[model samples]
Each structure stands twice: as structure tokens, then as C-alpha cells.
Target: MSYEGSFRVWRGDDDAGGLVDYQVEVNDGEVVLDVIHRLQATQAPDLAVRWNCKAGKCGSCSAEVNGRPRLLCMTRMSTFSPDEVVTVTPLRTFPVLRDLVTDVSFNYEKAREIPAFEPPKGVAPGDYRMAQVDVGRSQEFRKCIECFLCQDVCHVIRDHEQNKPAFAGPRFFIRIAELDMHPLDTREGRAEAAQDEHGLGLCNITKCCTEVCPEGIKITDNGIIPMKERVVDRKYDPLVWLGSKIFRRQT
Candidate 1:
């Protein structure tokens, strides 16, 4: 049940670093985080990795496992063979602050860009009620733990560093979609802002963000595509165009 697992963990800070090989003890029914802790205890005492609530709910232990963004606590050691060298690396999309931890402040910056949910002026906190079906739509997106895996995996900002400024990435796309879908929300032109400002158009529906989500959120299918459809409906539909023009004249 116990074996020496070959691990190649990235070591160093923002200035410079490389993958340092380590032979760590692995046990049955253990996750990657366990192996990492064992490595810290035995071999690499100075290793830098961030983790909390090792139960996978805190979203604090995100890293690239064999080049895929995943929660270290959720990825089981059994997924890889004993002979296979497991490569743990910092998220390539963000600036590396240390070993497994990166500067995730970009996600916080993107979070700041999002406007909070705006309810109609007349509706009191307790007086408002929404249908079960309507509430279900936004509820799915609320499950996000702010892990930033979706943002890290998104190619718009991941592959192209320049796109970071314009693109809000999948996490915020779902947030915007949640607010836009809320029946009681008074916000207008959400779809327009999604397309024009947040760089929603950059997404090609590849669903990479959905794949890496530990919560199994249907980010692309449930959120992004619906918002894309809304954007098309608002922009290209003749009746909507006419209504917009008339509303412009009235204003």
C-alpha cells in the first residue's frame, strides 16, 4: 500500500525556479495534497504551497497537476501510477509568487470589475419572491468557491497575457449571467456589456473552464452560451433594434 512516488515539483519564486525532483512516500487512499505534506515533512522543508480546509471546499489549494488545473486536495494519488512522475507546477496563467502559489490577485481585480446585483427600487428585502425555475438558474453559478481554476484555464487570458485587461474570463461570465438572468434584477444592457466590455466574444465555447471546475459547474453550457444568445438577440433581432432606436429617440 506504501510506495515511493516520483514527484517533480516546481521550486522557486517569481525571479527564477525549476522543477525539483523528489521521491516521496505515498500511501493508499491518499490525495496529492497528502503526498505533498509528506514531502514537506520529510524531504523539502522549505517548500512553499498554499492550502486550507484540505476538504476541497476552501478552494485554497489550486495548482497544476500534470499540466491540468485542479484542486490538490481533490486529485487522488491513485490516478497516477507509482512509476509515473507526477509534475506539480504553479498555475502558468498567473504570475508566480512562490512554488505552488501564484499571485491570484488578478481574479480579485476581475471580481472588483463586476457590479453587484441590483434589485428594483420598490422591492423590499422580504417582499420579493422568484419562481423556483428562475432561482435555479442563478443558484448553480453561486456554487463557485472562487478557486480561480476557471480563470486560470480560460485561454483568452491564459494563452494571451495581453487579453487579461479586456477579458473577465469564465468566472465573471457566470456571475454576469447570474445577475442578468435574475427576474428581479433591474440592470439593463448586461448582455451588451458582456460582449462589448468584458470580452465575452473572445470565448469560443471550448468549455475548458467547465472541465477543470472541481464543483462541476456547467459554466459554458449553462452560463456563457445563454449570455451569448442574449447578446445576439439584443444586437441582431430586428424588433429589438427598432425598440432600441425608438427608446434612444425618446431619451
Candidate 2:
């Protein structure tokens, strides 16, 4: 169950870099992160890899395995043929800090933009109660480990860095969707921001984000698309549009 394999790990920093190949030992039940760790131990101790917990919980080991976004600690070495060369690279959407480590601060900036949940007026902490179904829906999004794989795979910003400023990407879309769907949250303007500010309209219903999710969140169908529908309902619902025109107060 042990064999010699190869890995092409990108080596360098923000200024410049390239894929540096290395021959390494592979064993049964080991994941890609294991191979990378082995390379560090014996061959490339200076190799920079950002990993914590090695359990896929911290999500700090996110990288591109053969150009697809994945959690390195979760990708089984057995999934590849014994002699196949596995190429590990930093996330393409973000600036690389070093080998296998990219700057994920974009996600944090997007996270800060999402408004926190606010209860309806007169509602207090003691009065907080959510239906089981609503609570279940919100809980599913909370399962996200902040891996940002969804954001990395999202084509809106993956190929075009210029779009990054306007796009919230899939991860924060889930956050916005969760708050908008929460029955007890009194927050308004999330649906509006999703369309105008967050660029929810850019998504064309491709579920690439859901595919790479270690948590298996139904990011497109359950979160993005539903949020898109709500945004549409708010903007173009004829009855509401007419009601706004007729009933809007004049200063």
C-alpha cells in the first residue's frame, strides 16, 4: 500500500513563482495534505503550506488539486492512479502568499459587508423563537467551514480579478441568502444589495460552488437561486411596483 509518487507544488511568493516537482512517498489512507507534509519533512522543509487541524475543519489547507478547488486534507491519495502526478497549486482567484497558501482576505471583506440579523421592533432576546424549518435552513449554511472553495470556483471572479470588487461570490451569497430567508430577521435591503451591490445577477445558475464544497452545501439551488428569485420579486413584481407608485408618500 506504499509507493513512490510525484507532486508538482507551486513554490514562491507574491512577486513570482512556479510549480516545483518532487518525488515523494505515498501510503494507503493518506490524503494530498499528507503527501505535502511528507515533502516538507524529508525533501522540502522550506515549502510553505498553510494548514491547521489537518482535519478539514479549519479549512486552512484549501488549494487547487489538479486545478480544481479542494481541501487538501480531504482529497484521498487513492483517488488517483498510483503513478499519476498530482499538481497542487494555490487558489487561482486569490493572490498567493506562498506555496499552497493564498490570501483569502477577500472573503473576510465580503463577510463584513453582510448585515447582522435584527429582530422585528419590540422583539427582545427573550422573545426570540424561530420555526423548526427556518432554523434548519439557516443551520445548513452555518456548516460552511469558510473554505472559500466555492468562491475560488466561481467563474465570476476566478478568471477576472476586476469582478472581485463587485462580486460577493458564492460564500457570501449563502450568508445573504441565510439572513434574507430567516423568518425572524427584520433586516431589509439584503435582496436589493444582492442584485445591485453584490452582483448576484452575474451568476448564471452554474452550481460549481456546490460541487467543491466540503460541507456539501446546496449553494446554488438552496441559497443563490432562491435569493435571486427574491431579488427579482422585489424589483419587478408589478403589484408591488404599482403599489409603490400609488401609495408612496410625497415630501
Off by over 4 Å in 2: 240-251
Candidate 2 has which clashing residue pairs, if any? none
* Most lDDT-accurate candidate: 1
The weakest ten consecutive residues by lDDT in model 2 span: 242-251
Per-residue C-alpha lDDT of model 1 across residues 7-113, encoded as one tens digit per residue: 99999999999999999999999999999999899988888899999998999999999999999999999999999999999999999998998999988898898
* Candidate 1 residue runs with Cα over 4 Å from true position: 243-251
**Residue by residue across 1-251, what tens digits does model 2's lDDT show?**
99999889999999999999899999999999999999999999999888998898998999999988999999999999988999999999999888778999999999998888889899888999877976788788989999899999999999888898899999999999888888888777889999999999999878999999999999998999889888876797888667768888321
Best by TM-score: 1
Q: In candidate 1, how many clashes are counted?
A: 0
